[model samples]
Target: MASDSYDFIIVGGGTAGLAVAARLSEDPSQRVLVLEAGHDAHSDPRIKTPASWLSLLGTDVDWNFRSEPQPLLDDRVISLNQGKVLGGSSATNAQVFVPPATAVVDHWENTLGNASWNWETLRPYFAKAYTSPPVDGTMAETLGIDGWTETSTTHGPVRTAFPGDQSHPIRKIWADTFRATGHYMAKDPFVGSTVGSFTALASVDPATGERSHSAAAYYYPIKTRENLHVITNATVEKVSLNRHGLNHVTAKATGVLYHCGDEIKEVTCEKEVILAAGALQSPKILELSGIGNADLLRQHEIDPIIDLPGVGENLYDHIMCSISFAAVDELETLDAIFRQEPDALEDAAKRYAKDGSGPFSSMGVYSYAYLPVLKHASPEGRQKLIELLEEARPTKGDTPEHARAQAYYEIAKASLLDPKQPSCAYLAFIAQFVGAFESNTKSFTISAMHSQPLSRGSVHIQSKSVATAPKLDPKYLSNPLDLEIFAANLLQIETIIRTSPLSTLIKQPIVHRDPASNLTDLDSAKNWIRKNGDSMWHYGGSCAMLAREMNGVVDEKLKVYGVENLRVVDASAIPIISTANIQATVYAFAERAADLIKESHGLKAAGA
Candidate 1:
């Protein structure tokens, strides 16, 4: 028989939840209960193997959530695949552990109303979340790793190291191409403000070459602890709160009403009810608990607990579009393996069966860059960007909405124009990665992503059911500025394709993987981007941490406003998107959030 109560109840055991649970349970005096919608999946091989991450999509471990038809992208309903299993999206995402720009983190404190959330304050947490492996001398010089003054940090739970065949030419070619273009990073990417091209580390551990994620790093090590109780396949329907109407004392969240096994169950908590159910679902859970907009709650007959209008607003994601070019005939790419050629599969399997080292150990996406579009753009393109910047300038007024709009626009505009700031993140993959289908031609791709977007969208409950996913509308490229940003990036990518070292690797008279991506002019590129652009699954900002006057749902401490002992600890609380892959930021944020929770309850702080 399970206990009826615990010191803390975490709803949705994902990336952030498990990290908090592990930290809290360390005290041994407090009982921590985690209610996970998905089952424990540490034993799943698809998740364990580094390169087999792509096979896990649409499986039981994936939420497989799709967005509402986006009108801007030819009415395409883009797939937003989130992890359903323990460790959450960290287990399923591409194993890139890149950090965001320091300036962007500072914006959370300086511009946005989040106190103590600046770069200097949160910088240490990034080092605390993941450890960088020791890089060899020769590989170091080739990767510009020699330029790093010192190793950023030595130790942390989420293990990270460079994976794949270390001798792979793509690594050298990528670094040299950026060096030739004079965009190689000036400083260690993790030390301070990150800019320029880098050979980013993967989440795969050096010891076994398996994916090192939140579950494997945090949960598995502490699973045997008596104070921690984790219940799998437990879907929390709503947070049980003492609703005394909107104007009365804040409703106190006491527990969660969940579905487990064959019966509906109730689990009470004495301290706090934390929501770590990602960006899309956390807002849905809050709305389901009647802590959202009163009018929206009333439509589903859910009596309002708090009138927070920001529960499902400010939703945004990294919009990405790729342009792939065929590699030279002599170049060895992932084409044979991706195509499932019989001999190739047999050879790879034999190698993997021997020592867990083979094609199954790498994703071949180690090369990456963060570039400002204008710096690489043509002279005419540069003038067009200046004009666009003026046209898209946001006006701030008295309303909180206006304040948020202006703040985000100014930050984005500065990033877009400033040569020191990264406007787009480019991934160079050793495969034909333009579209879904396997290609007969051997090719490589450079995928460009709009890191910080000006456009905002929403994720709201269609009904009061927790089983149903919220209606997600990212409103991709709805803002004309986003379209122009994509166009500018496309022009830059064209220039990169013609540049020296990278250009030398490609086949003569380049062949594009997708016909639509064969760029001719600005108009054609814009049209192609609209047809092809999609989310990178780095969604956040629905339940943002800002001043309540700015329509923020959570306070700086991650506590829900007007709600007692209730908090949201997930990507949803991030006021805006980061500059690169957000896994590192999420881990660091979770680490800091754990300490904040401990401080609130007079518990032993975990490495704060």
Candidate 2:
């Protein structure tokens, strides 16, 4: 039987949880316990297959959380589905493994009050978490695969690949399209700044073409370790803390209270209680554990332990809007597969079953461009953005709550004006994004996402029960600047689609699934964004790691305020959301966090 006491009690055996558990338990003398609310789903084909990722949504392993009707988005209730299974969203996501902007990571330290959290310090952690695939031809060039990045540090478990044969004509078309416009990638995206067009890697193993997630990469290898114990179907209710510390200002974590099946169990943590239940649930856990705003806690009849008002505030996401353009009949898009053509389905199944190398090998999102406002927006649009920035600048000494907002506001302004910082991204998914049901019509999608939205929202619990879902309000497009940027980037699709090589592939009298998306004007584009914007599902900043006054829950080392032995090792602690898909950043953040934990306790891993 597993003991009731462990050196570390990790709640939420998802992405970061598994990484920390595996790394911490590297010391055979230290016993680590991981409690997950989901089951062992590694055997599920939907999780293992890269193309079956979308099928995993709304299933038993999905949390299937939705936002509370965004008023700015015409009161649309956006779906914010997160993974409830062992691997978490990493297993269920589109598998696009892209990194954040170099400027953004540097801001984590220079602007966000985090010491030694710059890109220079965290780059190795990214190298330590993923094993890169082999390089070849123009495929390697588009990927910016340099010599050093292909070194021995990439021996980490999470497998990543370029996905499929790179000989597809679309690859060259994409590079040529961007290169003609002087926006081709300047350097390797992995080690430095990424501000232009490049191919994105996916979290799929090249050897087997299966989904490479934390459960498989970090957890499975250590599952047999005597010191590591992972318990599934365990939902944590709260963290028990001891307030008898010096001056009573700090509360030391004692244990964790969780529900396993029908029984409520208590497990003691000899060292620390780490919360890795994702951004949506991590703050709620803290609120339930009596570490939230005093007024709100008492309203729910729960006693306050820390009175940290920042437990569930400052929530934001990349507001994404997609426009699917009809492609020429000659260009073979994935419309047949999405439309479920009998032949296409049979062929895809056969190809995947054969050797995992085919059209079904990866999500068709090879080409991506992280562009600044200069590349797309007209002179008028540029002026409008500048005016909006000045107009929305927080007034002098406006309020304490606006301090962090103001700080972020300055960065957004700098990022927008600076050519090096990309304000939005255009993801090339070679299929109809929303309406791909027309078997006769071949199409491709250009999904524009606002990288650094100034708009902020909140996620607070309704009641004290764990079953009661928190109110998620991303408050998307709340900032006027956000809409301007969204419109600017949205305008770039037509510009690129009209460019040579790529233009030849598009059918005449171009049709969009949403008729409103056919307009070319900036005003109409902004309207489209307000009415059609949805989350990229990159949620963060709820439990931020900033100063306490800036509505932060954790510090530089990720320790919760007023709690000595409590920490959050997930997206909940990420102060700034990454410029692209945040899975890479999440993996790197967890890797660095494990080192921080080791440093604090004077413990070293077996290999280290």
Candidate 3:
């Protein structure tokens, strides 16, 4: 018998868990319990200010999990920074608002068993999760007001702009020059299309200056709700289940076993148990519950209740690399200026605190472009990505039907990228990508991001012990084709920097590091990038949603397989990686999952 129990027990009080709790608790009747492995929310200055938040890295709030050494890139140990606190990565991420592409939604409908996941159906949830700040005259017409995550670019007094010359003598030059060169502007990066540069950002309120996180934007508003119990510093060890009579494999879940500091406790759930522990940890929780890969579990001396083989496979991430240039002068750049003049940093901080407008606005990462690397990519690159997706699709079997699926994918690709359409620069940083630039006379920086590469990896249970960290491999740039395309993309970026518009302002040349030894090279900078690239800190796709018996831990409805009442609602539920920042999309997933949970129970809507 359990000492205590609730209607739903949610594990991991980070971005997804909190969102689930917040949405379900709307009724004030249904009880939801959230367990966090980290500390209670704090008023730390570093967390409150967006610019200074980077200082939180490697601190108590960060999970700071380093991956096993990469066999490809000089065996470098990649650092995977996950949020250890209530807000999860949202508290630690740069707060970029790149929404999932519409085509991604279509793909979800086709892959996942539920067709209700299409863009039109999911759009409302996306709108409800955010609250957008007011945009100025010209920008107002461009941005979306319907989003639920509450994004705003209306800079407040204390919020600082990206640290460079907005009026750079070259910004207008580049914008006009790019237009003349025939590049089209992508309207809103989160909606319908994403292929051009538009003004980018989620501006914080000047009156508050503090960045709004999941805790603030979603959970804090309903923190005092009587039905919601949020437990921090409580690590869920495993979920406990009770078997129904023989042959009824769909057993009833009674409760979950978790650790509070060193004490083990069981909290039963009357209705359901949600593993909202994000991508990497969610599958691990299911495995701990004895609900995955039977052979692997038997080896670990644990009884296997479920035979799901896809518990901890299909991991993927975007790896980023960049060119760092020598700044011409201290005043013209943010890093150098702040370093050279302590007063400037102090002044910026003071303004943000006093007025919320200074240098605290999202560090200038606006401007972006999605360029395709493969123009009829080779059969090799498609093999890994296609095989994984096929394994997750439910069209019958690996029979003739499955083989025909390849044609559909090619058609989708041709529709999106028309080669006959004159080849424009396949690289860009105009909106939402370059982030705040330093002063004109200082250092120059341009980053290259892998938008939607065909590389997949994995995160698996190394041991059954709760104290051991799960083994993670991002498999970054694993495919030779991905390497070739990404390398070529790097060269394009180098071309823009070396061209007339940007070259005139260039101080020192950008050095490329060798992939094998991490050494710099004057020639073949592209080669170095392929060999030495690392993640952009975006980690997900583990325990992804798909049809049952189709290599999925969760259903299209986000419910876990073989478990009577378990669901995963976070970045981990994403079947395929989105082409942008994942925070906003995760919030949307939470919002929708909450409604689904409510509907499943035949419960009245929260407000109702």
Candidate 4:
């Protein structure tokens, strides 16, 4: 290894890696090395388009880790999709650029004991990571200034609009009708008061409508910088720990250790190594380096250096079930209608690639809906539903856990006799089973998420091999309250869908499936759907930032405990998931992490 040294070596050149590299390299005196396990920033076209999200799955750009069969969903194994590309998942996501509610942050700071993790301090970083363009005077009023990632309503060549769709009119009607029911419309959902419906924007360049990903804004700008080296197609095997007795320790980051292009060579980090390998890999890196819980380490027959029991505990994520509708016409696919049509998808993509305008630029969410289940339901009612879901969820495998999911599904279906009460059956009707939208008649997917999930899961190293993916435990619907919340949210969806103005677009009613009798009962259908729901793929919190006693992996600043010079700066550092899209929050966390790293290392500030 001729090149074995740098001031800072960042593993995983995805969203967090690039952001930290860019900010660190702003000082020419600081040398930064970014090693990516995947390919370069601009190598793939599928990652560039918003509609290409589904295609990015199962590719080299995706880690594609699978979860242990969930205890709740019939012991089903869920696919965990984390980005492996330059910009990471942000490069291959829906590009929805909305932030979490301020309350979410307040909760993290107050409840999680990370005092520096409040929204007031974080707001500036959010502004710095985005370039908010003016939108009907809303941009000036809503978007915060002073950010690196640009945002705007200028839907570029890739932008698409849905005004004439049957769902479009109904969405507005529902918004107004919901407002009459006491819900308020939010002009800026990111600032955190998300009590109502509002359009969301993403990091789309106003001039080109193309996304302003971390790679584009950070890595691409410094491609030729001699002091900075970004090596793609390289995998990190493990962190080499130099443990001095029981107290002192140092690490050597073995980089690009995996085979690539018929060649595999070992690269070492001479300077300090930073594990931005994300929540999943970061812990595995530490575990493979002889860190992690003593009991677990001994079980694996590995010597424990750090003995950090919190290495993979306190894992939390927003597991969601995406309820999708079948399109009324075959022309409803974004490809058939938008791409194949004369000036349809072309106009959007071209505008985005050229000057950053069009429908492709905006966050593609039809509307964000929040329904508080316990807010209106009785304590007993909520408790009973929670108990049922807890009993039903399959926790282990088909052996014992499988029986639970089945039994819970049955009891849950039987509990939804009261149509007026809040329940999962209702949520199914609104989220996935509801009738098709107008104009196109295509089905819509309303994701039923565990907003404040109680279930904790994790990812750990099964081996020291870099070629292997980590063992993941999402533990979906582990907490009884989570299932109840999902059930309640499902009911909310059903309620809105059944309402007058919104129901006008639904030519057909929502269909519910019953497994036992194999018949349709609207109430029980919701319960069945809940049992079979899938993950939203927003797995996070593996390296959660919490108090030391709680076995917190990282501090408020995202610095890994027991490590002198390392940190995990991504969704993994997020103590909790935001109410909105995770991308913008991830960007903000990266931006904040960049600043924190700079201050800690005594680097020059931005523009200095």
Can you give the lDDT of residue 445 in candidate 4? 42
The candidate with the higher TM-score, 3 or 4, is: 3
lDDT of 3 at 331: 22
Residue 503, model 4, lDDT: 54
Give a tens-digit lDDT track for model 4, residues 221-268.
Answer: 677777788888777766655555345653333332433566766555
What is the number of backbone collisions in each predicted candidate, taken in the order shown? 0, 0, 50, 53
The CA lDDT at 541 in model 4 is 74
CA lDDT, every model vs. true structure: 0.85, 0.85, 0.63, 0.60
**Candidate 2 lDDT for residue 68:** 86
Cα error of candidate 3 at position 16, Å:
1.6
Candidate 4 lDDT for residue 72: 76
Task: Indicate the residue-level lDDT of 505 in model 2.
Answer: 77
Model 3 TM: 0.83
**For residues 1-608, could you state the per-residue lDDT of candidate 2 as single tens digits?**
29999999999888899999999999999999999998989989889888788888899998899898888888999999899999888988999988888999888898888998899999999999999787665455444333223233377879998786565667667777777788877555786756887777899999888899999999987799999999999999999988866666668899999998789999998899999999999999999998988899999989887889988888979889888888888776777877778998899889889999777888788878899877435677567677878988986775548889888998898888777789888888888886535658888788888999999888888999998988888888887778877787888777877888778777877677778887588888888887888888898889999998788899999999899889999998999989988999999999999999999999998977
By lDDT, highest first, what's the ranking? 2, 1, 3, 4
Weakest 10 consecutive residues of candidate 3 by summed lDDT? 155-164
lDDT of 1 by residue, 1-608 (tens): 26989999998788888888888898978899998889888988889887778888889999999999999899999999999998899889889888898889988998886999998998888887887887778787665465556458648888887777777777777777887878877566888756678778888887788899998998998799898999999898999999665567588999999998779999899999999999989999999998899999999999997889989999989988888888887766777787788987788777766776778777778778888875446677667778898898877489878877888887887676667888889988887877546546678888889887888999999998777788999998877898877777776787888788888879889777777888877798889877888889999999999888889999999999999889988999999898978998888898899889999999984343
**Per-prediction TM-score to the true structure, in the order listed:** 0.96, 0.96, 0.83, 0.78
